[model samples]
Target: MEQFSTMFLSFIDTWGYVAVAVLMGLENACIPIPSELILGFAGYLISAGRMEFFHATVAGMIGGMVGSIVTYYVGSHGGRPFIDRYGKYFFMKKSHVDTAQRWFDKYGVKAVFFSRILPVVRTFISLPAGFARVNMKKFIIYTFLGSLPWTMFILYIGWLLGDNWKSMLAVGHEASLIVATLIVLICLFYFIRYKRNKKRL
Candidate 1:
């Protein structure tokens, strides 16, 4: 842990603010960089007097927003055909994407707003929203609103936890798994009931 802290601090010393922006942006861009560590590292920097709180927060938000815009455009322009051809590399299947699209359609802007804070959902919600051709202006607005609090909260964690930041990431990952499992179970139950009702009819 001490070695990691040293290496990370070294990174901050070398790249400064741009590294924060780029890492956070890639996280949103589906590159699998965990925001927990990304923002946490920034927070640690702040606590160590190497970074400013406002600068780190703003950079994180800006980086995340930029990455989200890129994802939104990819979903909007490429559409399903692109996904059908290449999404498997990302472990995405058509039915899953279709389900997300339906949910987004039913919920509209609220889906995008909430998805920004919901674990893995935050990572891919833009795809279905883009496929549905949601308004770009509204999408950006809700995404920013959703991302702001998440950024602030996670950055706070990093600042607070300091050397123990890695542990928080583990806990977050496990929590995401639990939430995902619950969602799957709920969906499965709903599907079974719907099918049974159809048979009765």
Candidate 2:
């Protein structure tokens, strides 16, 4: 973890805001790049007078939007077919896709907006939205709105931590686990209820 942090810090230090945008973009693209490290270090730099706060946040947002747009298109175009054909390899099953579809159908706007704030869910929410074929305009608008606060929040946490920004990485990791577990539990509860109702009928 320290190695990844050092690597991202070096890149951001060398490339400035460009690094922030690119790193955040890759992260939102569902790549394994950690936004906590990227924004946290940027916040630390802002404290050091190395980077401007507004500029860094904007760059992060732009990168995040660009990456998410790319993934959205990937899902809109070929995500469902790919998942249907070869999802098992990636640990994504058809039932997972169907669940995403149901969520989007029932709460498309809220799902897109709030999912952007959730840790693990935020990362892949765009793909599901794409699968649902949500309106392009609405998708872009909600995505941008959702991501802006989150970008600011993460950057602020990093800024507050300053030299100790690395500490937040552990917090981010744990938060992700918690969110993932809650989602799984909720899904299981619904599945069991659906089964019981079906048997009653």
Candidate 3:
């Protein structure tokens, strides 16, 4: 993990905020880059006085918005036909999409904010939001607001850990697993209840 940390740290150190923005944008665009690593390393740079905390954080947030906007437009343009043709390849399940849409329906704007921080949910939640034709201004606002805490959190870990930022791999993974498991359990509970309710009808 140190190897990966070093790599991303190099990018941030060498290219400064540009690296943070580009890589963060790619991550939010679902490009498989880990934000924990990116923001964490930037945090480490802050400790070393290699980067400023505010600048790094802002770049990350902006980049995330940029990537999310791109992804949002893709889904908005694609709609159901796009999902029908390519959903599986994107790791999207109809049940999950339905749940997202339903949640968005009930919660309105808060769903976007919450989704931005919920592990795997954050990545693909935008698709359903876009598919449901959510208001663009509200979507953008909520998405950015939701992402700020997460970015600050991971980066804060990096800042505190200094050279030991590599240690975050274990810490982050363990925390993420616990959160993800809880989310899965909650979803399963609701799913089962819905099934029973449907049967009763």
Number of the predicted model whose lDDT against the real structure is largest: 2
lDDT of 2 by residue, 79-135 (tens): 777757865664444664565566667777668876776665677777788887788
User: Measured by C-alpha RMSD in angstroms, how accurate is candidate 2?
Assistant: 9.4
Residue pairs with backbone overlap in model 2: none
Q: Higher-lDDT candidate among 2 and 3?
A: 2
Q: In every candidate, how many clashes are there?
A: 0, 0, 0
Q: In what order do the candidates fall by TM-score, top score first?
A: 2, 1, 3
Residue 94 displacement (Å), model 1: 6.8
Using TM-score as the yardstick, the better of models 1 and 3 is 1
- Indicate the TM-score of model 3: 0.73
* Residue 146 C-alpha lDDT in model 3: 76
- Stretches of candidate 1 off by over 4 Å are 1-13, 88-103, 173-201
What is the model-wide C-alpha lDDT for candidate 1? 0.77
Question: How accurate locally, in lDDT, is each candidate?
Answer: 0.77, 0.80, 0.78
Off by over 4 Å in 3: 1-9, 83-108, 173-201
How well does each candidate superpose onto the true structure, as a TM-score? 0.75, 0.76, 0.73
Off by over 4 Å in 2: 83-106, 173-201
Instruction: Point out the worst 10-residue segment of candidate 3 by lDDT.
Output: 175-184
Residue clash pairs of candidate 1: none
What digit string (tens of lDDT, one per residue) describes model 3 on residues 1-201? 558657776887899899999989877765656788788788889999988889998999999999888777877899967876787785566666666667667777678887776655566677767777778999899898778877887788889999998787657656455544655687799999999999999
Compose the digit string of candidate 1's lDDT tens values, residues 43-69: 877877888889998998999999888
